[model samples]
Every structure is written in structure tokens, then in C-alpha cells.
Target: MSTLQVRVARKVSEADGISSFELVAADGAQLPAFEAGAHIDVHLRDGLLRQYSLCNPPQERHRYLIAVLRDPSSRGGSTAMHDEIEAGHLITISAPKNHFPLEPAARSLLFAGGIGVTPILAMAEALAGAGADFEMHYSARTPERAAFLQRIAAAPYAACVHVHYDSGDAAQKLDCAAVLGAPRADTHIYVCGPGGYIDHVLGAAKALGWPAAQVHREYFSAAPVDEAGDTAFDVKLASSGQVFTIPPGRTVVEVLAEHGIDIPVSCEQGVCGTCLTRVTGGVPDHRDVYLTDEERAANDQFTPCCSRSKSAVLSLDL
Candidate 1:
């Protein structure tokens, strides 16, 4: 994939444990244009790559703004960004890619949890700019932990945005059922955040008879999988007709690389969909949050970084 060298123009502490970075073209030229709900893959030291959503308005081409929350359980990306990277530092990042895109709707409803507000914030900017009808609900653990409170308050569409806190009074809390109400064909819902929070919002919509097509979501991290029942499986490469056994605890990507086969991968958690490969035959266990239920049911493709096989022998179009 092509990449752009950018300079960290500035970095500011947005909240208690969150920091926002403004990246400009290294040569002071215009950067590529991006849309709301898009993210860039930041290439870090030691081959660590992390995807962060663009929070700034999409119309701006001068810089890309991304926020990172210092995750205590980070696999290295968030910790390095918080500790090693500094202002004016040069870095390489991929162009913006949007797997979670905004669709045309009569009325839009957006729910953001913690740092998940990154993409939802951008969507708000776009929706407000277009003069579209929309409502945004932001949830955080506390007032001190919420990022971009001032920015959102200062926005022209501030009246449409609502803030909720876990520590706040129950009367001010979010009532998902009341907000979601009866599903309308012309209304769409978008959610991004922690797995449990996403589940709550989606579950409310589901119970309200919302069509799956009207609801969209993006997961920052997948829920932990129980691998105790995982068993060994075999995979065959289409090009070489080579068959290899994948042990219970080992991943397909790791085993294949040992034999000189390499597949581009990022967010080995299976959230990025970078190592998604075509499956010629056999069923996959489907251990990823990237694909929708319909896509998983098709069984035509699978993410090798974390997903495993269900059949005894699987075939990959490598």
C-alpha cells in the first residue's frame, strides 16, 4: 500500500488519558482528502501498525486529526504514541480508508462511547455541514474522561449533541429505547465504541424491530474469544497446493510466514480486515468483528490474522 510521510504538527492532551495529534504533510503540501468515518493506518517503530479514526472535518485537506486513548492493555501502539511520539516528529501513514461510511438518511442517529467519538465526531461535522437532521449522543465514564467536550459545544450544531456520563445523575443518563424509539426506514443508526456499549445500543435497536440494514457499527476492539475448545486444522494454498496444519494455539498468519508466505496484516485482533483472504473451500470459524452477519454466513472470505477454520481441511486462494 502507498503511504504518505507526515509531520506531527501538534499534540495536545484532549482528556485525562486521551491525546489528539494533528498531522500535516511533511513537505507542507496539501494532504489527501478524506470522508467522515475514515481511518488512517499509522506505521510505528518495530512494525507496529495502528488504525485511528479521523476526527477533523472532511473538507479540510491541510491536516488529519486523530485521537489516541492510552490503553492500559495496549499491544504497544497506544503506549508508544503516548510515550515516544512527539510534536514535529516525522511518521509514515497510509491514506484514509473507510469501512464505516455514512449513508443518506432522512434522519441520522449517532452513538459514541469513549474514544469511539473520533469517527462519530467527523460524521457530526459532515451532517451539520449538509444541514441534515441528526442527533448525537456521547457517553463517557465521567466528565473528565470525555474528549472534545469544548469542541463539540462550540460547534454550530451543538444543540443536537447530547452528553451522558456514568457518574452523572440517572435523569441525565441515556435511555437507548427512548432515543431509538420506533425504527423508520428513512432513519439510520451508527455506533462505534467498546464491545459491550455497542451491544447495548444495537440490542435496543434490535428489540425495537430495526432492520439490520438500518444499523451500522464499527468495533475498536473485539471481545475476548474462548479458545479452550479450539482444535487443530489444516489449510491448503491454492497456488502451491501446499497443505499445512495449524495448531490449536497458533494462528494461520504466523505459521504461513515461517514457510516464506507473507500476507499483509494490521490490527492482528481482526478489526482492520487487512489480512482478509478469499476462501475457496471449507467453512471458517469466523472469529472476527470486521464482517457482518451476512458476510460471515457467506463464508467466501476470512481474516487469517485471528480467525480459524471449522472444517477439517480448508482451501485458501492465496
Candidate 2:
């Protein structure tokens, strides 16, 4: 959990297969600060870490922008950034982390699909540089894959950007019930894509009543797993009471890193609560979109790299 070499300043091609890059700070220095729904964890070659978001405009300190989407069914970090990343090289990332932030509502509604428009295009440029009040809606599967759509159609809050498609025409695609049916006690929606477009925009913003803390999301992965209903549990480990054995297809962070216990994961697909931990006893099985549902009915905490255990013995706090 250290990294930060950076330097890849600008790669561009933001569309069909996505791309974008930008980085910076290899020697120019000034980086370590970020906000609008952050994320950074590149670190590729072999270990393949991957978590990309942070699409420029958290008051841009020199660079950072991300994007990527080449995943033609990728299991190898978007095919190693579309075949060995290039522009200026460097790489090794991790530093800007945010389990999809940008809270404090009273106006906001982003939602993005396809490349999940990288952190809702940095929360619509930090809610249009803090003048607050937002809109976005994006969706894509046409409009040439929509990654940034002409820089969100020339941004300066480009009239709160809208764009939907899937080849467009059904009253301009994306409806989620005419933009999230009707929940607005002062807005707040967020969402990021893929798992069926964050389950149809949080199930139409929870069938249009919205609140569950105003509906936020991020999940660029994790929701497929079902190794025939995985079970095998047992963890323990309250700082060295070490038990282990988590094997119905391994996880509990790979059985606590096979005993030596690593525990520094980053988006091992539980959507970056970065291996959350701190459970006190069993009942976890919450497959993570990073908690909530009253933090999974207050089970204390879970997500040992993709959560498990409904009580064959969990107990972590290690």
C-alpha cells in the first residue's frame, strides 16, 4: 500500500474502446490530494491491481485523469491497459482513495454507465466547482461508446450534461423512470455502472422513494460470484489467535494470505472498501457494494476481499 510513481501524462482516445490516462507527478511532484469520488491503485504487471476512477477535475493538481475500458472480457487488468500502457510509461499507483465520496446533498444526480464515466466525470467536476446543484445522467452503448462525449460536450457544466443512448431514440434512452422517477428532497443520487447499470439505477432509486441514504454507488465489478453457493468459513484471527481455513473457492483475503496475512487489498472486487474487516463474530455474507443497508444490518464489518461466512465462525478484528 505505498506506490505512486505516476508519469503517463496524456494518452487520450476516449471513446469506442475508451482509453484516457494522464497521470503526471513522476518528478514534478505536487500530487497526493484528491476528492470527487477518488480511486487509484494501478500497480499492474503480474499482481494486476487495477481500480481506475478519478476522471480529472478535483481542481486538477497537474494531472490524474483516468478512463480505460478496453476490457473485452478482461481478467488481466483491461488487458494490461490495452496492451502495455505507453505515453511516458512510469505507472505504479495507489494513493487517491475514496470509497465513492462526494456526499452532502441538497442537489446532485449523476449516474453513468458504460465506463461508468469515471466517477461520474469526477462528480461533474466537483459539482461544477462547488457551485453545487447537479445533473449528469450519461448512459452509453452507442454515441460511439460515450467516454467523455466531447469532454462532456464541452464542459463548463455544459448545461448539466445529459447524453443517454443505446443507439438512442426511445425518448433518448435512459429513463430510470424519467430520471429516477421522483425522489428529490433535495437530490443526491450518484451511481457508477455495469452490474446491470447499478441495478437499474439503484432499482429506480428504490422504486422512486430514494432514501437509503439518498442512493450512492460505485461498483465497477463484483456481483457475479456464486461458486455454487460458496460456504466453507472459519476465520478468527483477533491479532494472532489465527485460525484461517476459508475454502469454498478461497477468499477471506485468500485465507488471510495463506497464514502470513497480508490484508492490504484494493478492490479485490468488493468495490474498494479495500478489504473492510473488523467483524466481531459471524453473520457476514454481504457481497459488498461497500456496505449499507444499515451497514449490512450492523454485522460490525466484513469484506475480507469479497465477504463470506454466515457463521461457521467469522470473528476478525485483526
Best by lDDT: 1
Relative to the unseen true structure, what is the C-alpha lDDT of residue 118 in candidate 1, on a scale of 0 to 100? Answer: 100
Candidate 2: clashing residue pairs, number: 0
lDDT of each: 0.96, 0.83
Candidate 2, 1-318: lDDT as tens digits = 677898897788878888888989899988888999888889889888888988889887888989888877788998788778989999889789887888888798888888988888888888898899888888887887787777777878988888888786888888877876677788888889898888888887888788878788878887776779786878897867778778887788876777677888866877778778888877888887778778889898978887788889988899
Query: For model 1, what is the C-alpha lDDT against the true structure?
Result: 0.96
Q: How well does candidate 1 score on lDDT at residue 258? A: 96
For candidate 1, write residues 44-97 as lDDT tens digits. 999999999999999999999999999999999999999999998999999999
TM-scores of the candidates are 0.98, 0.35
Off by over 4 Å in 1: none
The predictions' CA RMSDs to the true structure, in order, are 0.8, 15.9
Clashing residue pairs for model 2: none
Model 1 pairs in collision? none
Looking at model 1, which ten-residue stretch has the lowest summed lDDT? 166-175
Angstrom error of the Cα, residue 200, model 2: value is 24
